[model samples]
Target: MKSRWLVNLALLLVVAGIVAFLYLKPQEHEETDAVHEVSNLKLADFDRVSIEFPAKAPVVFEKKDGFWYLVQPYAARADQVTVQRIVSIVAAQSHEKLPADDPARFGLDNPRLKIKLNNEEFVFGLYNPVTSEQYVAYKDAVYLLSGLYSETASTQLLEMLDKNPLKPGEEIAGFDFSRLEQWQEVRLQLDKGEDGKWQVSVQNAKPSQDDINEWFDGYWTKIRALSVEPYTPDRRAGYPTFSLKLKDGKQVHFEKLQESPQLILGRPDEGMRYTFPADIGFTMLNPPVGLGK
Candidate 1:
């Protein structure tokens, strides 16, 4: 009976060993096998990107002075986050890769979209029904990548536009609110003093340095618009205009387009309209006065 019990124990140990080995071996194999990335190109190295879709003009972006700018479909500042998403295709990885010898089988013969990062071009084709991955042809090979790459490339031009009212890295030195009805009499301007501190033009209203800085840096400097679109030229003229003077001696002018439901500010020079929530919009024009006391 003891011999029989020992034999049963040995069989159980052997079964446990087999289960452990079977579970760990596949993990070891997966670790050794490196998945292939779609392209060898690095994001920082490629400064130019051009995305072309079927029956639509190609949109292009160029990096200048460490900032991305939309170079096609009318020039404007490109949203950094959106551009990064489109450019990230270069680093995309794929489990399956095949030769580009037969392009039609994967729909590469007539690609749905083409994205060029500098000189390296990636052609997007049909989606794989089984895996639901997109077929992309780059260089001599075709790769299966997530459909997100194609979706980001297909984003509308306006959606890609930067929503910030001011240019990236621009510092506001002062605001000229002389044209605004409420501030016209006071000639309200928030300008930097000779000591490099912020001061308001209103004589009766005295706000602390911290109060001014909070409004400038915490609010105006970091404010982002809800949406941005091309400005319409036919909009009613003589709208209240305000200008922000930057530290570099450049002024960005904004015309108040709407007030009640939402506040819309139009930059005629850039031909862009910036929409903002009405509550926050009023504070932009009206600074903190006597609040510091």
Candidate 2:
């Protein structure tokens, strides 16, 4: 009888373990066939963009040779980060559907912001006061997407310009300067000694290594343009006073323009000129007088 009772207890424990296993199992998320994507098109497939805001003319951006360029208002370089952010947010999913009994009531008639990715266009409308979601009209469907989409797509033309002038392709090794300070001509060369110490030389004299390093680092790695202007073909006059040579054998030439300009730097190869303060030239081109002075 005791042996029979022990067998019955073992069976009860096995059943309890089975029940506990079922209870502790993780259930899969429900899958649905319905798609509520804000943008049916992929961002990679879009080669051009046209953005319009209420009471403002549309600003168009075109991608050429894998680089984004502004094609409207003024032809210039486009900020890739700003453009991609808008495309990524719109490409996301939105499941919330809001009532659209009156188009005018939800700002659908004239969307506050409109974005056309390639051939397809989307309109951004009012924000729901209670839920704080935004209304968007795309492909004959009005969606109540997160308000974050509206905020991202709203961008200004000037804000989308690339602040950095040249798409310099290589790490800078060193640079050459002629008539840098109106009287001084310098040719800087950076090389590592057998001991792996960096040394910079100007002509036959070795100037301050710290000053040369600081100039090169700031000019190449950290310089930002004040503005970029469209290029017009004309006599360039002469070679650049300041020339930056990359490690990859590509040389970037710059020519200063006009008198007393806050910004000046022109690149004829890309056909788009960039500008920085006139004082920057003075700061960068002024070399150290003598080492250990």
Q: Model 1 — which ten-residue stretch has the worst lDDT?
A: 25-34
Top candidate, metric lDDT: 1
Cα RMSD for candidates in order = 4.2, 7.6
| lDDT per residue as tens, model 2, 1-293 | 99999999999999999999999999888987465776656778878888888887778888888878889877778888888877775577767655556778789897788888887877788888987888888776788777766576565566678877657244555555554444344454454344534565544565665765666567756767777656764564763455666667777776656425564667776566676677775555554535444
- Lowest-sum lDDT 10-residue window in model 2: 183-192
Candidate 2 Cα errors over 4 Å, as ranges: 1-36, 54-56, 99-102, 146-154, 168-171, 182-201, 207-211, 226-240, 257-263, 268-282, 287-292
TM-scores for all predictions: 0.84, 0.67
Query: Candidates' lDDT values, in order?
Result: 0.88, 0.69
What is candidate 2's CA lDDT for residue 203?
Answer: 49
